[model samples]
Target: MSLNKAVMLLKIIFILTAATSIQGKVYHPSYIDEASTFASSSEYDYIVIGGGTAGCPLAATLSQKYKVLLLERGGSPYGNPNVTQMQNFHISLMDTSPDSPSQPFVSTDGVINARARVLGGGTCINAGFYSRASPSFVKSVGWQEDFVNDSYRWIERQIVHCPNLAPWQAAVRDGLLMAGVSPFNGYTYDHVYGTKVGGTIFDKSGYRSTAADLLSAANHTNLRVLLRATVLKIRFDQSGSRPKAVGVLFKDENGNHHLASLNVGEGKSQVIISAGAIGSPQLLMLSGIGPKSHLKAKKVPVVLHNKFVGKGMADNPLNSIFIPTKKQVKQSLIQIVGITKYGSYIEASSGFSQSSKSISYHHGIMSAEAGQLATIPPKERSFEAISSYIEKKVKKKIPIEAFRGGFILSKIAGPNSKGHLKLIDTNIDNNPEVTFNYFSDPFDLHRCVKGIETIAKMVHTSHLLNLTNDDDYSMKMLLNISVDANINFIPKHFNDTSSLEQFCKDTVITIWHYHGGCQVGKVVDSDYKLLGVDGAMVVDGSTFLKSPGTNPQATVLMMGRYVGVKILRERLGSEAGV
Candidate 1:
């Protein structure tokens, strides 16, 4: 048979196989139900809100022995091509519809960002890089080291996959080594200081397996997952000396309200908010657990005055160099990462195709200016403003071909610069205003400068230089060494410290590794229990003081399982009168 016919036959077989597999995997989880079908009220041993990265695994682990109800504001990711297909990464973010899994929001700091609005949370929409928390990070968080390791292994076994490095990725890996980032760690899920190929949630077939897939480990009979259930407020019993979270008031997709309550007689029954960094803190504030003055200003009845609910928000600042090569690079997402001692991470992705709509709306460095104008929905923009903005940006439109190349990006590790989240209103659907205050701290700024300098060194390295044609303008653009470099692009020289610093500030973008709104010790205890309330806790990225490892997803997934086991052990001991 001809090669073309053979390839076509393979594609057909793969699609058929994938269709059958998906039917068994996502469609019939059996425990999931739409919130529209939910009764007016129900009781459970545990009520977990937000079925994203952390929530799904937490709920699944809890359901192993206790009755658990998991509430997610978004729909299942089952048939979403933009989410499941690795090639359609940017397509998911381009969708600005109300029901889009990737929810776009601009920070007050003027950086564009996105938050997960789907069942699997950020995992459903992210680049899928997976790495465990550094040992030091684990120790600082006060988790038992052995338990943390075990939890990571549990998650790795379930959802993580070792990615085969594409040509561009392999070249980037060698480039990182040549740049003096040293001690090549080969392929590892462990967070080590060096260049390494990390695990990904996308498998060999380029299909994603999200935290929602972790539900396969759950006791389905004991778990009830409700989709399109936006929890409006935490229902607290104030009759006691201290407020206790008893239930939650939530609305379904159809706007009908329902209450899911914790079992009254079960003293250990609790409500866990795993609603991510932004959502968790916002939920807490809306539920009247934030700053007393802020809650009052929003007309929310205060249950407790924590003073700190939406503070310490931090997002690692990312600066990238887009390298358009003479030779077509294979399409890839994050596979190789350079973990440096200079408090920076170097990562790369190559060859992504974005729709024109996405390019217009993308908040990345390429069209960030246009993105600012596009932030407002089309209906909200005046026709004149829309036309004028489009004329300027779209008229000089970047050809889709320019995007066929890859990005070599750098993000500062555990950025010391922090900001806060504030309520614009009490509605959970509306995103709370957040400011990351990127590079406000001199330490963070210094780290960024060093990181960018490192990138310059990498591009000049033999590995990357060998890949670039000598006459190629893209290589010269790396450091703007050649007069032939693209004149439209602003190039930063390695030795020019001022230029690098300015470049860092001017082109700053979010890697979407933001964390710490409802921070540890401030809003919740080490055990993740809410400081001011009984039978309540926040168990998500919001509790993190820093982003763990190279990416937070793997650690977040591990956290769910870790915390669930902890809670289960405590409950079991309590039942046995220990």
Candidate 2:
């Protein structure tokens, strides 16, 4: 470890020691392995499902004053090199194991999306670029701005850190400005439009402190975390007039069944589902709390007929430009972002060229369009939409010894299209059917096309001229996209918007920012309480009304903190509107 990380670790230890009575041990232990260390049959003040990005902090905060049980479907990240190392960020996604941190799946729409199955969730595997939620997002969701800001503070101090920008990332910063994304705002985590160096989860030593680290401030005496514990369903007690969530039934790593129940009371006991947008909605439907007709079709008993359980699904789609350099450049993930006004954001990452074997074909969350025509109607499909399909696809890995250059990614910051998640079968082992009608809205397609043109312009900027041009900016490197586009073609000019649409159709994929399958104001209230259910709540990205204008990690963290406090406040009769 570097001196910077050593000091930070030591400082954390110091705080834990100094405040031991106030806070308990925050360590990742396999509750299933050590049965004596955990309870077999017990009651918790709260049962928190899915120890992920949202679940970790939410359970940690709740454990301060109440007994909380947090269950994770995958193993711990404590000893996983692929999860704790910054450069190995992509390695976990390449994992095909059933319990991989990122569980890969193909959507009904033929989009390749992965759901987080491990502790700390996507923060354990995603590009570490971090930023605050847009102020508009906080307002639209009716979140207390002060509480949200404070919640971010609790996370930033633990896992969030400033990145040491390398030469390639610096070039990306300058290039974005040269492309007219002006007024560099220096290094800050505030959400704003224009060029800015945001926060990162990777420390200066390249070690990542995941959201699990936030548990250090949790009351371990009141908290219990079970890894390899798959929650099959939310057990409901409909003995009263309204159905109440009483507990959850989960299986341990040994395939032994266990039931975790809430303390006996009317509204005294609670269940909070933080299993993410996909898992949360799927679990709801399986528990018979979704649409009546859909649940009945799947042979699930009707509990409450919530018509909008799995209706709106939004994913931020991106188009990438891979420019291979002759010389080796510095390596890093996301460091700088160019937030523009054209309903798009241009962010760049370095450091991938060093890891040659990891960039697999699965990187394309949405494959080429020809294979996708099956998802749509035959009348809606056309021959022109099939360019660069399976035939023109690039190789899984680049063979060049020193393949180093820039990777400029253009993402539609705000998308108009929405999809849904439905049950394929009644078995909990079976995955839910996900359909992302990505470009279903022509306006969304138009926005992504505009983003593509913006990225092309950024590539040709004077700041990045050194990439394609030699000294004196005359001769240039080969614009050979034979592998990427499958044709020997050079850009006629930087502002070429004609092939822009084709490029997006061919290479665009999801950035893996999925939200709104169980949206707020539609399915749940602003406070995140299930509309027709009592004693159950959701505090994950599934509650997002729309995708925020930036990466959703910080926003998700804020929601966890906000809802955690809200639950605690209501329990105490303070009723603070956080």
Candidate 3:
């Protein structure tokens, strides 16, 4: 070989070695020192507590211009194989209960539903079902026209919500449509905001993309996300006339106390709380920002005394009506579509096949004939009323055929329920008591009962009858229509004659759509700035003024973006002297 060629080969080898070393230096969970602790006085430009739905996006966006610190109560999900895989979402559900201390996820009073506790927050463990809030509901929250319009466009660009065409979702969709459950085809983009015709599924990529995706892209050295760092209390500056949120006092998994504060002016710092509905309110109460009466009971010194801090607690009550299928579904049809279309795009990096195969069936019942129920006084609403309403709705909706063939009825408890989150104990680690008082409002119960009856009619319709009949030889017979077939079948399961008033009493659980505790117009202003506090802001589901009549993820994300933009504009304007 020529001498020149040999010299060139050595130089190429050196360059390759250098690149490999740099790549290996990338930060991973294992590299973070678990034992290494941060000081109580250590400060940053922005301290975002609770790295869930709102926190992640807020941190990701603000980090672009400021030095941000994200604090989460849960541990790092990075190396955990269960969090990374898509199918593991269901598996992680079992680990998400409030009682499951080992897991970071919590439920109301320690019960588990669908919330997550990892780095990406709930998006990491949620079913990845993306739906926008109804525009009507958005307007009710005092969002101006321009803000709403820009939010819609910004969210679309940030998180991609293509349809889920997976085989599993496809099968579910086909089964639903074939059975007369029509697809909601109207106004797909803003369907979640107000009225929805058909259920929208999660986009493919196998897994739903979360704030982790965006955060990963930013990868700035000035920004840091500390997981398993639960905020115990908000430290206030005593020198201020009105207490200012100077820092956060948090505890690690090992139960060691640490504090993260702001270095304002010189560094210009602020604290954004996005710990979720339950977590955010609880944190405020612990820090002495809630009702004076409640804090007096807890014996915590009151700082702000906002009576509305945890007052307007609200959640959608969901009742499910299960209908047995005649044919054995081998796999969910939507899953197949998601796998093929979304999977293909992920692998080949081409085409419009961006949706996944998760199927959702949503049915809305709005009646001009039906008048809105009278609003129940907050003190008068009770659990009994809530349950009774659900039962009444189910009975009215049951079809004669459904009476013959068993069909499960799922109803969303109306938006009038009055509930609150109160501190059961002074311990920050202890879960707060969440009084859902689900069926408290008579009107809420009435609407739910009406909704059930509506669903029953749809189930008994011809479209459903044809799909459920045992025409296929391989399928099991769900309903028997032979002359000698038991007539009691109709009366037994779908007994319309009998009062289903007991149904709600039997089964009424929160739809997991808890909101309005630290409500807009009440606890915080429209901009999400706490009315009484200077440096504190509540930007999670708790800030929702009213229930959006659907899942709250999209709206929550929009709120995060809105808050981020507002903060940036204010800070940047000050800096630029505009």
Of the two candidates 1 and 3, the one with more favorable TM-score, higher being better, is 1
- lDDT of each structure? 0.80, 0.71, 0.53
What TM-score, computed on C-alpha atoms, does each candidate reach? 0.89, 0.85, 0.71
What is the Cα-based lDDT of residue 226 in candidate 2?
79
Q: Which candidate order results from sorting by lDDT in descending order? A: 1, 2, 3
| lDDT tens digits, residue span 1-578, model 3 | 23233334433542453454334433454212331266554568888887777787677667767778888776555544335445333334433244221233223422223444666676665545455665666677776667666764665676655554533233333433443344434435554211222222234445456655546534376577776787888888867677777888877767787777787675346788888877888889888888999999999998878888877777665543433444322221112111111100000000111112111100011000011110222233333332243234432433323222222334452367667888998886666777666666766565555444444454555444454664431112323321222211111233442333334423343335677678878888877777777777888888875655345666676677667766777778655221
Q: Model 1 Cα displacement at 432 (Å)?
A: 0.8
Query: Which candidate should be chosen as best, given lDDT against the real structure?
Result: 1
Q: Global CA lDDT of candidate 3, please?
A: 0.53
1-578: candidate 2 lDDT, tens digit per residue: 33234334433543443354335433445332322234656789989888888898898888878888988887767766567776556556656556668887666655556788878887888887789978887887777889788899978888888889887778889988877787899999887878999999899988878777776678888888877788888989898888889889888777777888998654677788999888999999998889899999999999899989998887887766655555656767788888887778888765452333323222221122322212233223333222223223433222352145656778887578888989999876667888777777887778877776776666666666676455422113324344333422223343556555555554446678888878887778877787787878888989886776579888787677767887788776554333
Best by TM-score: 1
- Of candidate 3, the 10-residue stretch with the lowest lDDT total is 341-350
Instruction: List residue ranges in candidate 3 displaced over 4 A.
Output: 1-42, 79-86, 96-115, 166-187, 192-205, 217-219, 266-268, 330-409, 461-467, 471-498, 574-578
